[model samples]
Target: MAYSHDSVADIRSESFPDYEARIEDAYIEGYDPASLGAPHSSLHTRKLWFGLGLILAALFGIGLSVWGAAAHIWGTGTQIDLSNRLLVLGLIEVAVTLTLGFVLIASSRKGYKEYRKRTGRVN
Candidate 1:
């Protein structure tokens, strides 16, 4: 008797794949999860600070845009409509910052989970 096995699932099922998530998971799995507890969490503190800074900067830019709009800077000669674009650009900056913030938050969560899984640290 002979038996055969397929190495991979059929392509038609690709639509249901979790490829991107799996890739991200694989990358995260390569890290040392045992070092994620409190004292060691400091390793990620810098990232948190950086992320905070980004959010602050984005907020500052948006504030500036709002101020410009309130002041009607776009109505000024030669600068007309410029403030509108500036505001739009500021909004874009905020959006990007928000995205990065979410990513950082998720990474932190993954880190904590990994730490718990590897070192039995509960937090």
Candidate 2:
């Protein structure tokens, strides 16, 4: 193994056995478990935020669709027809949000579990 980044261009076949071990050690040492905790935890936070946002959006859309339907049914306020796409869109949003939220929560839990197992960090 060669330390040079451009080693691909310089094809010298003399093997340095220690280089591979040194590189692996350096890579492992770069991550401090005490400081970083678990790397996937950050990703879990992001996924949770995104999923909640989607859920909120879905709720808003559903509210809008219901309001429109109510207006049409009551025949008093601004009437949006039953054929309006808002109802369909709102239903789709709800399905998508629920699916994504479940997936994110499951994956994040698995990742955190794996990280804890690897680090042997029991808490």
lDDT of each prediction vs. the true structure? 0.62, 0.60
lDDT tens digits, residues 1-123, model 2?
659776455345555333433222333644544424544464537776776666666677677668656555565345445535666766676788778877766655776677567655542
Quick one: how many clashes does candidate 2 have? 0
Ten contiguous residues minimizing lDDT sum, candidate 2: 16-25
The alpha-carbon lDDT assigned to residue 7 of candidate 1 equals: 60
> Evaluated with TM-score, which candidate comes out highest?
1
Q: Residue 55 deviation, candidate 2, in Å?
A: 2.0
Where in model 2 is the C-alpha error above 4 Å?
1-44, 76-84, 115-123
**TM-score of candidate 1 versus the correct structure, residues matched by position:** 0.50
lDDT score at residue 9, model 1, on the 0-100 scale: 62
TM-score of each: 0.50, 0.47
Model 1 CA deviation exceeding 4 Å by range: 1-37, 40-43, 72-81, 117-122
